[model samples]
Target: MATGDNLTTTAYIQHHLQNLTFGLHPENGWSFATSAEQATEMGFWAIHVDTMAWSIGLGILFLWVFRMAAKTATTGVPSGLQNFVEMMVEFVDNSVRETFHGKSKLIAPLSLTIFCWIFLMNLMDLVPVDFLPMLAQKIGALFGADPSHVYFKVVPTTDVNATLGMSLSVFALIIFYSIREKGFSGFVAELTLHPFNASNPFVQALLIPVNFLLEAVTLLAKPVSLALRLFGNLYAGELIFILIAMVGLWQLPLHFAWATFHILIITLQAFIFMMLTIVYLSMASEKH
Candidate 1:
């Protein structure tokens, strides 16, 4: 075991990285997983409770703060919160204007929500990694639960499922608008036609399978790439934070230095996710 913490380096790292999962256990039936091994046993049906709770909580917070800002907004030299909210709104509005050429009013609000919600979620990583988890462990202790079994990961974006859920949502919108803009035949043709069309109908027929294979991979990659990119970046960042915490006395300085640089990574990732969603939807909405 390491000095201050009773866990070894490997155990400490694992503890910080694991999510508080809840699902149906074969023997225990429906219950919360107290450990990563138990979580794995809980299987495909298991949900990351911490991820869902934090993501939803931050989403509601974003909405509430923005709503309050909107309510308290004034034309006469607006307050600080209103100014900040307006600035964020303008930032997203401009990003959408530049990137999305689509006609739908949904893009602007959606972009704003995506940017703010994701930024807020990523923002959780800036908190000391052990802080919330330790708090959770203490809370568990009060309930007669072992501290060793309490797992809680604060940053939602670090979880692949959270990122994948958001990306799959954008993917659904992409498909919906693609079909709406180009019709069912046009959508099917997009997958089966062009990108390698032939003048002869017979040759074009042969190209359909190849074209569909290529296009299907391309279509699927949108969500897969979006999810992995966000997950990979944040997961690496979280891992580094966990590693740094193992350094004992010198963790604070290193944490600050890394966090200072990480702020850019966090904001950039959210912006990239937002921009990609807009661009993918824009491509879908276009009458090509």
Candidate 2:
């Protein structure tokens, strides 16, 4: 079966990977891309409209669903949605309780949000890859844009920017928690004196810079690793789906097989992201 755009296999995969971008056009001022070359040139200045749209939309949807579940929760017999929500809540609460040493009213809720929001974003990969983009093409036609140029990638977690944005947010929380739990002086001391101790004044002074550099790298690695791990996994999964689609009708069986196994990968990645976040925050909240 031919794709809606009737692109060759390579072009189809490239098109699927392209984000629906909007950016400053030299000729058109702020405008959406009318060509892949233009979108590529937009580069760092361009915003991935599709990724942002789906990410924010899914986040809102997650909050709304949980809010509704909480609002309608009953003491007696719980409905299926309520039961599912409670199960997720209890799971996140237990995970945080087990991992987080310090008390914060925010950890459990944060964990819940991370798990659900990321899982929902990752869930987009399981959609038939061409369906949403095909819809986007139709929408582009209404705007008098060339339908073939209207690229839309629906999986937010597959985008590095989205992953890094979330990781950076977690990094900010870690910093805030570190400052709140340890005073400014203590936090600075940890950076300069940790993982190395010297009794002599001159030796301690000499080690401060070394310790700071090492610790800074370690601290920075958290967000970098978190971002890359999630992005790599989901992006690879999405790429596999796109590749499988290139095989024409033979893609159906492979698609089903890969997607079935990918469900585990998706859930595990979400859980790992949530758990690492909790652990990192817990470490920050500690005095040592």
Candidate 3:
């Protein structure tokens, strides 16, 4: 348990917010932080160990469940798990078909993974605020670690690094698709010619820099928007939950109400992320 000296509300909130960070400590080499000050000293090389663990764990869970459903799938009728999995698969397939203009074997599965994995991550926010952290503290004590300093954050989507990591992966796929659909020279020309074109040689040559600048910004903005929008909404929602929990016994009603409303936000954000990814890739695959 935390000492009474560390029992202030600000300390409580900050403790919940801090990640279980691990990295090369400035003085101690590679290690986990025993305190927030130690975490900050680890600098840019630090990784949010809890965030990576939860996110990757949830992702593996998704794949295992879907794989099991597929393995047991029946032709005539379906089990409840199979039925639900089929419905989700059909929904993702339809969404990808509606949005993506070009053909690729990867889009349907990628969209499904993004939607389901993100939805799972967002669902972690619905867990009771202090339950896992408390459990983690108990476990830490068993391992001879300081329970007060051991921290674990459950929701991965609320972390900016996690969101940006997923978005940047999508950005890489966009570049790959663009290059595959259009040759290297064609890709460069698309970045330096369209939206403003000229037949005259001199005028066309002069427009290269202008077109490249505009197109570059537009391309970069897709991933930036994807990352920030998700991180912003989920972070704000998590913060609100933390604030409500500060009310003690009065928090129950408010917590239930916010969690109910937040279901829509979570589902809509996942859909938007999947759809925008499809749209961006579609745009990249286009000739014009």
lDDT score, residue 286, model 2?
Answer: 93
Q: Which candidate leads the pack in TM-score?
A: 1
Q: Per-residue CA lDDT of candidate 1, range 29-142, in tens?
A: 899897788899998989999999999999999999999999989889988999999999999899889978768889899999999999999999999888888888889889
Please write out the lDDT profile of model 2 over residues 1-288, one tens digit for every residue.
Answer: 245556677787888888888998677768898777888777678899999999999999999999999999999899999999999999999999999978799989999999999999999999989889988888889989898888899999999999999999999999999999998888899899988999999999999999999999999999999999999999999999988977878999999999999999999999999999999999999976
Using all chains and alpha carbons, the TM-scores for the candidates as numbered come to 0.96, 0.96, 0.94
The whole-model C-alpha lDDT of candidate 1 against the native structure comes to 0.92
Q: Write the per-residue lDDT of candidate 3 for residues 151-228, one digit (tens) a residue.
A: 888999988899999999999999998999898998998899977899998999998899999999988999999999
In model 2, which regions exceed 4 Å deviation?
1-6
What overall lDDT goes with each candidate model? 0.92, 0.92, 0.90
Model 2 poorest ten-residue lDDT run: 1-10
Model 3 lDDT vs. the true structure?
0.90
For residue 8, model 2's alpha carbon misses the true position, in angstroms, by: 3.5
Q: What is the Å distance of residue 72 in model 3 from its true position?
A: 0.7
